[model samples]
Target chain A: MAEEITTTEEKTVDKDIAALLTSPPKRAPEPTPELTGKIVKPKIVQGAAAHYKPHVAKPEIQEKLGFPGTLVENWQEAAVAKMRELLGKYKSLQVYMDICVRCGSCTDKCQYFLSTRDPKNMPAGRAELFRQVYRKYFTTEGKIFGKLAGAVDFDLSLLAEWYSYFHQCSQCRRCSLYCPYGIDTAEISMAAREIMDSIGLGQKYTNEIIGKVHELGNNLGMNEAALRNAIEFVEEEIEEDTGVPVKLPINEEDAEVLLVTPSADFFATPHLESLVGYAKVFHQAGINWTLSTTAAEAGNFGMFVGSYYHMQKIASRIKQAIEELRPKRLVVGECGHAWRVAYAFWNTLIGPFDMLNQKYPRPQHICEFTLDLINRGALKIDKSANDEFVVTFHDSCNVARATRMGDKPGGQFDIPRELIKAVTNKYVDMEYDTIRERTFCCGGGGGLLTDELIDVRVKGAMPRMQALHNVMETHGVNFMALICAICKAQFTKIMPKYGIPMEVAGGVHQLVGRAIVLGAKE
Target chain B: MSGLTLLYTLFAYVAIAVFLVGFLARIWKYATTPSPLKIPLTPAPVNSVGVVYRMVQEVGFFKSLFYSNRIIWIGGYLMHIALLITIVKHLRFFFKTTPAALAWITSFEIYVGFIFFGALAFLFLMRLVIDRTYYLSLMQDYVLLIFLMLIAATGILTKYYVRTDIIKVKQFVMGLVQFRPEAIPGDPIFIIHFTLVLLLLIYFPFSKLMHSGGIFFSPTRNQVDDAREVRHVTPWAVKG
Candidate 1:
């Protein structure tokens, strides 16, 4: 009888595990608000995502980034002071604080809101966490009217909400696109994070990666030897696959171009595939390009956390690499926020690249570089090489909405698709409204791509997944091409949870890697 | 001048002063606030001229709103357009002789008032009915919407139900504009409309209504997307 009881208990435990794995622990899947191929306005559910925050950074990780080592005494006062400091420092913060009319245009625009059904995830609602504090402290109306002015005082509960909701935002700026005032929640989320960090609270995933980058020169913390060994393996993979000894030279000074990519490219699949593609493009184009050891990383977590100081400190390594290598030009690899920082913030954070060949745009996107080579007849692309995969390009939010590629307007959108078409025989866009500026985030970006927030990440990806599922049904699309490393990582891990194969996530250059005609220098 | 006329003249001057000073102060603050980064929301234009044209679409046509939600767009666009026509129609009062354009604009007549009322009413209902919008709307939001509704309601009533001495009302407004006091019209509807207008003017810069001018200063809307070509730097950037 005792043995029989033991067997029954074991069976019950197995059933519980299956249930947990199959369904969200908290609630059944929401009936997705009837979407119109445009916006999905989920019914509001308060506190829906309150449980899905990232792990807080350790004291040491916090200290490494120049934040307080722990929750300091008088945390409220310190947080308010930091808000004041940021308000004075960034005009985006100040304007966004006051100008939001609480219009509902942006309410349905956020992926987090649509997935979690969390009212707090609404772009304006997420921003209000900080805006409430801003109102309480800075604005005269808030000072007098308080809650009536849509402002609330800083307190434990509000801080908790700030931590949960701000971290939920990917800082994709998709909401900013629809906002009449262009009130960006990315700016607010960043400031909220900066304030939290100032008061000695920070996220572990971003801060630790940033700390690793500062110490080991990459987010993955692969030292020079490990990095070198990994690339050698990639080089071997290339030679074996294509019968070409295409070199991915590292730290070779005086090369014509210095390529800086996110460290995930060194070892991570799909990312590494793109990295291989970069080498092939240079090899065929016959440009003398070298990856630098010092500035090995391209993604900046500082931008994610909204700390310019950390962003610049992390970005300075690339500038140091540029100085040490003395390359005539700089080229960035397939990473989203890295491209944004390189294309937009690098000149401001780092400076006048008068040293580089002024004839070329100082830092060119890999897509631009590859496309130019293809356009100029400098390289050959065998379009039929990628026939096995019916591919669709996912426009990374940073690329589509934050930064541009070629000189033309909407170049960011056109350039990637142009590059994809040059290499692939079969290409399909997911949905018209879901492409270009209206593209949903790949569910993980802006440093929220950590394992601890898998539920948040998976649910947040619902909109993108549903859209992908639609295309997969109609067009038999087996591949989703992406440019961002975080997007790549997020989609690979989270896609399977939604019952889509993880292999559906492929890099744009992974396609390029297959298509590029190596040893065919035109 | 009668006592009511004298009292209104004083209130008008005060209201206009607060409106002008507050609006300018907010505008000045927005203008002087330094934008340390190039964060233009793309697909933004690359040059100054393109930016101007984009701003024209955003400000004049509510392009972003139109693209975002057609229901909200219809309500917002009509409301703002109605207000614009109504403001233009009021030009007849300020000018000694109404311009041909003003006469043509006023020809929209009670249609403008009805559209204004209808649109304002739709938006107010939207704020209450939409669950997401309801969650987002604060007391201030509802209060402002209802206040505007009341303003539009009174204006409509004056045109349709309680006909006022609008000619005398215009004369009184002209007197206020020219700093020459005239007898105020003695209609309750006219008094309420005039008082509401003055209060809204005074409240404009202090309230969310400053979106009128704030729209121009939004860096994402205003700045050109030429970060790659230009080495834009903040004054406070770390020096080597």
Candidate 2:
């Protein structure tokens, strides 16, 4: 009874302080405690994003992925065990858990933290959510010192915090660039998610998509016949727009190139437009390319969840497609993180691609293919075809900072800008700090693209939008060219919220489709 | 031998043992751990030589910290450089005759203690003043910085103010290395500094200070970007 009264008194005191801070009196001090430790900084808003948790996965989705159907009765036990398993499995997780000194170099680096002013959205702060639980259950200092050493027991509240903040991270690796130790919070986010999933607490967006890939070979759950129909629709759409006969082949044996693109290209706009671009690029270059329904998707959400098993299962479809179709060359389309998995992890996931021609990269980017044609002067580009709109490229996070293109150090940045300039007369760039390896996220990468997380998504996109706002003022930059399907989908949905047109978001290849000149056939 | 001397000696050996064995255990864990994937943050160097250069830039010059935030880079870099020099220059205590390079660097040692003291104070102030860092700082963070500052303070005082007998201090340090327990100089500041350092050493391997060894093991920094050219395979990740 005494404890209850004291708790109530403390609660009332906190309420009084909150009221005083929000609705200030003339002057009475910020309770001495609030303003004393921190100098009046508005950038440290607590609880700003604490409520913005994404929807959890339903039991059916959980069971489909071979995980437990619900949050287990022994969730805390399972979670700690999972953490131990991950610590043993991933050297990245193990090393990262030990090394961070919280120096604040990366505090301002994460966009979510920047836009939301929520300290937990900070890279180190977000990683600390997981690290707190890691300490109590894993390390000696944490075991002894407990909260003094930044350790907290694995509890429901911590799990709730993990779900909210871990999904908030786009796994962009932007903070890693600035971190003195290169402590990638994206790696930590993935590990936190894996632990959550082990306790039957999975995010609906990423897990459902992974399950869909297993069921129907794509994130969209589009089956073999439906995928074929979508390609045929693209072929018709292309003929209608270009007045040129372009063939989008499916399941074609003896085709020279196998095009495995993100499923969004077949369904989503601007994405579909880029699909048209890929078809036209192949048609004009006089190269043979085909889509394989068996491996219909280039986007691998498995990588998002940090499940090597699912990542391998999702990517092994491409291997099956190669065995069945025997395409001499492999080409990937405009999807950022998927391209990262394809470029960086494909060898490990599905290896010894001796079947494919060794003359080219095992899995080539579609940008590389189109750029090579323009360089060879085999395909003519009419730069003025896109003269109406001033364009800028949004470097997808995975491509810019996680994986490379064209074998150059920053080819991911250079190749797209180079491709855009070759095809478009008017091209501008956003602010320097928010472009290339330092580029901001499209606000919806890393499986945060679900509608439930739209509030944080819109908030997260603010830094990029603010950068975009700058380009618009100085250069009349209207179009934002993107290479990732997630970027396209994200910016299209989010541009309107920020008082810009949705159509401003598009693919690099969408411009290529506009500028390519199909010469009179020989 | 007095009980205090024997106790101090025993604790000193224990601290040294914990520091060495704990640090190596952490390093061995990092070194032998299999990185199942190539996850170099890109625009990364494609070859091993480039990776070595990247590591050099990270470790030798604090290049990433320099790029991160100028204020932190200033504080952190000074602290590290001063600490490195101070550690090397103090080798004079262990050496019967100091090496030429050690003697030459010791000439700069006058400013190192002050610089170190200033840097730790700067870091502590920064941690307190910065809203983000203040919220992020665990008690261990502040406690560790204070320990370092206290160490610097006593070392500085002994050099310029209290003036402990240099020969006795050197004899004491050398005696520990040679397995001979000698009478420690009885200055209060000196004893406080020495005790704090021993406690820090015992705490180091069990704490975030392992970042000193762990940074080199960071896959993001250490791994080369040759995933396509080289089929890098980890033991557990290989499929049947």
Per-model tally of clashing residue pairs: 0, 0
Question: Top model by lDDT, which number?
Answer: 2
Steric clash pairs (candidate 2): none
Per-residue lDDT value at B161 in model 1: 93
Cα lDDT, model 2, residue B158: 89
**Best model per DockQ:** 2
For model 2, the superposed segments whose C-alpha errors exceed 4 Å read A1-42
Error of 2 at A398 (Å): 0.4
- Checking candidate 1 for backbone clashes, the offending pairs are none
Candidate 1, superposed: residue stretches over 4 Å from native: A1-40, A520-522, B107-110, B238-240
**lDDT, candidate 2, A277-334, per-residue tens:** 8888889889988899998999999988999999999999999999999999999999
Which DockQ-derived CAPRI band holds candidate 1?
Answer: medium
Q: Give the backbone clash total of model 1.
A: 0
